[model samples]
Target: MSWHLFVVFFASTFFISATPGPNMLLAFQYGLNYGVKRTLWTLAGLSLGLFILLLSTLLGLDVISRQSPWLLTVIKTIGALYLIYLGISSWRDTNNSSLMSDASAMSAEVSAELTPNPDRSAKPLPRSLSSAAVKSVPNDWILFRTGMWVSLSNPKAILFFAAFFPKFINFSAPLWPQYIMLTVGLFLSETIWQLIYTIGGKKLAGWLDVGERLAWLNRGCGVIFILIAAALIVDVISTL
Candidate 1:
């Protein structure tokens, strides 16, 4: 791909990635519950899942879908169900007093421990509080898997990549090098936006640390997940 073409592709993808989607929502939610450091695992999983979708598309996912339409339907059904499960889980956590108490206790502990240190800053305590609140935050592997499954659940992504990549690719020339360049450019854009969402969520969590506000925010995200799942179900029914 020429520099001019690559630039155009990058620009297009940057804007597309900026749109809020399941992957970004996961990152944001995780960032609110965990910290940015823990959210990195989720980001990595999201990238790997996206890479798999893009690779599958390049390797003839379109042909596979045409030959076995039922497979896509199966995937959509499973994806929607998984999204609903996540939504319900989030809703359940909305009134989790233990989590809030743990976070508040940890915040007090950190403050007490740091009280004697004249140079210690208060900025890091919020991050510590967020992570501490969820005493049983899933391990790194679970977080990674959650992100991967969430990304992969949307079978439409394969169709999207199948349609979107061809516009930027030059089939005649050597393809592997172009694929590498394009992948890097796309990942750069995705990573930047993922971090932005994560940080934004963390900031919001800090700002909404007051009573009930954070719980309501969690509920709102749950609603968004279910809405997206409902849309997916509707699309699947329409396709059939």
Candidate 2:
């Protein structure tokens, strides 16, 4: 692609990425709860999801998506339902967790101390409510998977990339080199932007009162997620 086209694409993508979508929101949410360092895993998962979307688009999923609108709607509905479930769960967790056992309390205490990493056997986690099964925050891999799921679940992302990426393509030229260049640039820039949001969230966490838990933030993110889910539903309905 020409420099002018690259600039336009980069700027557009950067700004669009800056917008608080599910992926960004998840990064922000996790950043607050898990800190910037751990959030890197989540961001990595999001980037992988984006890479898959771009690759799928390049491989002509865009054509299929365009041909089958219902597929997109179904994907969107499924994504929305997932987010709605998360929102409700997050909200309820924030409230109910107020009375939760001490095991669930802490920044990353319970999760780190009790729950073994997925690589480990499940023999450790207590059945009822010991330090282990206290509704603790997830570990790194779980957060990463959460990011992947959130990104991949959003059908809007597939459609958006499908529609948006083609505009800057130089069909007359060799595709592979351009693909490599654009994907690398796009991925790196997006990663940087996501890091900023994650770091910003971490900084915000620093400002919270020492005693303040992540419950309020969880509740807030839950509401935002529900709104996003609602918006997706509204969009789907509008299409019909």
Candidate 3:
């Protein structure tokens, strides 16, 4: 691809990745609760999922979906149900002790501040309890599967990649290299952004002490996800 085409493609992909979506939000939650390292794994799984989606679409899976109405319907139902289940879990887990584990860390910091002679020169603070909670959750195979399921189950994401990936290609030349660059760029940029959010959220652990604020944030994201799932389900039913 020419530099101009590459730049435009990169810019567009970056912008799309930067938009706060379910994956990014999940990354943030993972980062805030787990820690950068584990979240990195989640991010890896997520990137892999995206790449698989791209490859599948490129391999004419979209054509199959178009030709098989029932298949698409099945995907839509599964995707919507999965999203709703995730949303409800998040909402219910708002008060999960794991989420509140950072409370002790914050208390320790406050206690140290109150002491007359706290150590002036200590090593950099370790990750917060919130991050520890994330780490404590057994990510194992389930996280990988969840990432893959969420990415591949959504027909909308497939439609998105199908519509978007081709626009960056130059039909005049061989397409493989362009595909490689686009897929790599998309995956890297998206992964990096999620990492940034995950790491950034870890730094905001102090704010976790404010239970009200944290609850509000959780509820907000949870509600948005629920609404998105509802809309997707409605669309599915209407299509049926």
Candidate 4:
């Protein structure tokens, strides 16, 4: 690729990845809860998922676009439903703060009952089901599956690949080199922005010291995700 083309690709990729989306939100949540390390893990998983999606598209899996409209419609419907489910689930999860409070209160009561000396201060136990855990280290399979599904199933992603990825290629030039350039540009942009998001999230985590505060933050993030998911659903439906 020429230097001018490379710069265009870089600029486009950077701007697009830096924009807030489900991937970035999840990465930020990962950073806020599990710290930067696992966010990186999550980002790595995301990269792998995107790479596979791109490769499949390059291999003409998208030829199904000509073969069957119903199949594509089903895929879009599934994606839309998934986004709606994520939104509703996140919105409903805001009530988790009460659960945390109850757990804390129960722990205090248990500690008080167990202690013979009333003068001794009772220590609170760590919550088993923490917002940080749910937001950050999702169940292993779920994390991987989410990465794959979010990247592959989203109609927006398919539209993006269809409209954007092909624009950069020179059909006469060697195919391998163009693929390599696109892959490098795409993954590098994704990784760099995700790292920035993870670092910012860690910094935010520092402010959320108390369990109640963290719980509130988690709810707030959940709500934000829900809103984003709702928008995604709308976008999908409009396209359909």
Candidate 5:
């Protein structure tokens, strides 16, 4: 690929990656929950998923998929279930800071009411701040798996890759070199744009710290996941 062609590929990928698709939305959520550093694990998983999706497309995964209808159903089912699992996880999660804030507010209210009646007999324990930290944290593996689940579960992603990749590929020329170039160009562009989105998410999260409803955010993300899964399932049904 020439420099101009490379530039075009990068620019095209930038727009594609920059668009607020499911992956970007999840990444934005990761940024809010884990910040940029931890969000990289999710990004890494997504990048790996993308590589697989693109490679499969180039190798004609679509053709095989077309031949076997059951395969498509199986994939859709798995993806939908995985998304539901993620949604449930998100729905149940609560921010530690939010918990701490509530605890503090309750403590103040209790203290005000009990000042005169000094309850020396029995006093409840204030929550340990250390425990709050633990409740807020998640391991890297969970984040990585969440990213992969989103990428792999979307049966449409492979189709998108199949459709998107061939526009620039030259069959007359050696294929591997073009594939390599596309891989590098797309990954670089994707990483840059994903990082930008994540940073923006983190900043927005900072602004929302005072009034953020983390539970609602999680539920919203979860609902979106299920909706995407439903859409993919619908597509599968229509194709059949």
Candidate 6:
């Protein structure tokens, strides 16, 4: 592929990746709950899942769709159901503790430690005890798996890749090298936007630290997930 073509492809993908989707929503939600350092695992998982979809499309998803269309429908149905499960899980997760509360607790603990206390014999509460109200953080593996499954829960992405990539591909050129270049370009775009969403979520969490705003934000994400799942189901029914 020529430089001009690659540039165009990159531009198109950058805009496409910027669109808010399930993957971005996950990154945002995880970033708000877990912070940026841990959210890296989720981002990695998202990349892997997206890579698999792209690879499957390039390898033979088009042929599979033509040969076994029902299989695609089955995949979509399962994906939609999984999304509904995630949506309900998010909706039901009504943890009252916000990151701001945790920070405030820690700050208070530090202040107490710094203050001259007459009761030297009385020890300060342990860090865990002080922040006991905060929910336990999920292990890294759980975050990664959540990201992967969320990404994979939209099999329409495979169909999207199958349709979208061909417009940028050159049939006359050596295919694998072009694929590699395109993949790298697309990933670069995705990574940038994912980071943007994560950081944006973190900042939003900070602002919404008052009362139940953060909790509502999470429920809002849950509602979006269900909406996307419903749209997917509708599309599947239409195809039938």
TM-score of each: 0.56, 0.55, 0.54, 0.52, 0.54, 0.56
Q: Which candidate wins on lDDT?
A: 6
Q: Work out how many backbone clashes candidate 1 has.
A: 0
**What's the C-alpha lDDT at position 15 in model 6?**
57
- Candidate 2: list runs displaced more than 4 Å: 61-135, 202-240
TM match of model 6 to true structure? 0.56
Question: How do the residues 57-83 of candidate 1 rate in per-residue lDDT, one tens digit apiece?
Answer: 665634445577677566566667766
lDDT of 4 by residue, 66-172 (tens): 56645554544454455445435544543333322332343234324433243223222236435424222344444455455545545556545544554455544
- Better model by TM-score, 4 or 5? 5
Candidate 6, 104-200: lDDT as tens digits: 4533343244333433343343353334422445566765766777678788787556545654555546777888988999999999989987878
What are the runs in model 4 whose C-alpha is more than 4 Å off? Answer: 61-142, 202-240
The 10-residue segment with the lowest total lDDT in model 2: 98-107
Q: Please tell me which model should have the higher lDDT, number 1 or number 5.
A: 1
Query: Candidates 2 and 4: which is better by TM-score?
Result: 2
The parts of candidate 5 lying over 4 Å away from their true place are: 61-135, 202-240
How do the residues 65-182 of candidate 3 rate in per-residue lDDT, one tens digit apiece? 4477476566556656666665676566555333224433532332344333433442333465533342234334544554555455556677665445444554446667877887
Determine the backbone clash count of candidate 5: 0
* Candidate 3 segments exceeding 4 Å error: 61-127, 130-136, 202-240
RMSD of 4: 12.3
lDDT of candidates 1 onward, in order: 0.66, 0.61, 0.58, 0.54, 0.61, 0.67
Worst 10 residues of 4 by lDDT: 116-125
Could you give the C-alpha RMSD of every candidate to the true structure, in order shown? 11.3, 10.3, 11.9, 12.3, 13.6, 11.8
Provide the lowest-lDDT 10-residue window in model 1: 114-123
